[model samples]
Structure formats: structure tokens, C-alpha cells
Target: MNEGDDDISVDKNEDSAVLASPEVLETSFFINKPSKKKLKKGVFNRTWLNWVEYKSFLKEYNHDSSQAACIVCNQQFSVYYCSKAEIDNHIKTKKHQHHMKSYDVNQQLIT
Candidate 1:
């Protein structure tokens, strides 16, 4: 082969060696990706419960303060008293509505 061909082959070999190196391969495969931002705690308004009045509607699940389970649907939600929108949305769900109806029927029967 010519001198130019020898130089090209050397360059290609050097590039192949770098590409096949363990450090480069490991770095490419196991990259340290940025983690998702965690939600801020205790930022909710203390008086958030006043908006929807869910205290009588939802009961605490297993006595855990962070979770509120619907008395009607039995669906649990992560509640911060300030998250009235979340509570309201869940209450509006079809499942919640169905359970509410069933609960009413049972209550009527009991009385």
C-alpha cells in the first residue's frame, strides 16, 4: 500500500481503538442523567380545607395524615388541605359518583 493509505489506516485504527475503549463505552452506556425535581413539601396553605370542606366527606386512611380516602368510593388520594382542586376533581369522577349513589342507597336502607 502507498504511504497515504498507511496514514489513513493508522488514523482509522486510532479512532476505532478510542471508540472501543471501556471508559468511553461505559460513559456512553451508564450516563448520569439528571433526576426529576421533587415536589416541595408543606407549601400548601394551612387553611386549604376551607375551600372544599372535604373533612366530613373523606376519612383518613389507616390514620395517615397525608392520605384521605373517599367514604363513598374508597379511593385514596394524597391530600394537603390546600389541594382543594385535586379533592374536588376526584369527587367529580364517575367512580366517586357511583359510589356516592350506592352509599346513599345503603344509608337510606339503614334508616
Candidate 2:
């Protein structure tokens, strides 16, 4: 009928077409699968750290014995009783170093 009425109908048709498209429907079923990463065993595997060593640097995280949180930086880490490499790597991070420095300063002030 009117030019404006025609444009309105065309827009509605396009919107409906997009909503009913098979591709749009199929997209709802699409899911991204996560890839599983294989962890390489470190050389220190099978050697567990004693409580003194563990407590010196890490604290129990989330009440999970298998996970540890750094005492200085509060960074969470997996406890591989078999390996010390992971713990060593975390301790060597710049963030850990910075936090450790701050912790030492605080301790000095407290004393």
C-alpha cells in the first residue's frame, strides 16, 4: 500500500527469516570442547617435601591437601608430592619475589 508500509513488512520478513534460519538454530547446539593437556613429570617426582619445608613457603589452600597457596604472594599451586619443580617455579616468579620482599619488610617492622 504505502511506501513506509512496504518497508515495514520487508524488515519484519528479514527479522523472521533470521530467527528461523537453520544455521541460527544449529548454532545453539554448538559447543566448544576443551583440549586436554598432558603434564610432563618433573625430575623430582616421587620425592615429597616435609611439613617444615611445605609450611615455610606454602599454606593449605581451600582445605585441599593437594593444592597449596603461597604464604607470601597468595598464589595457588598444585601440590605434586612427587615434584618440587612446580613449587620452585612459583617461588621464582617476579610476583612472588615482590610479595616476599614486602612480607620481609613487614616482619622487620613488626620486630
Instruction: Work out the TM-score per prediction.
Output: 0.46, 0.47
Q: Give the range of the ten consecutive residues with the poorest summed lDDT in model 1.
A: 41-50
Report, for every candidate in turn, its global Cα lDDT versus the true structure.
0.65, 0.64
Error of 1 at 90 (Å): 0.9
Cα error, candidate 1, residue 106 (Å): 0.9
- Model 2 regions more than 4 Å off: 1-56
Error of 2 at 29 (Å): 51
**Per-residue lDDT of model 2, residues 32-97, tens digit only:** 545578886433322343555455456556655566678788677775543466787787889988
Regions of model 1 farther than 4 Å from truth: 1-56, 80-82
Instruction: Work out how many backbone clashes candidate 2 has.
Output: 2
Most lDDT-accurate candidate: 1
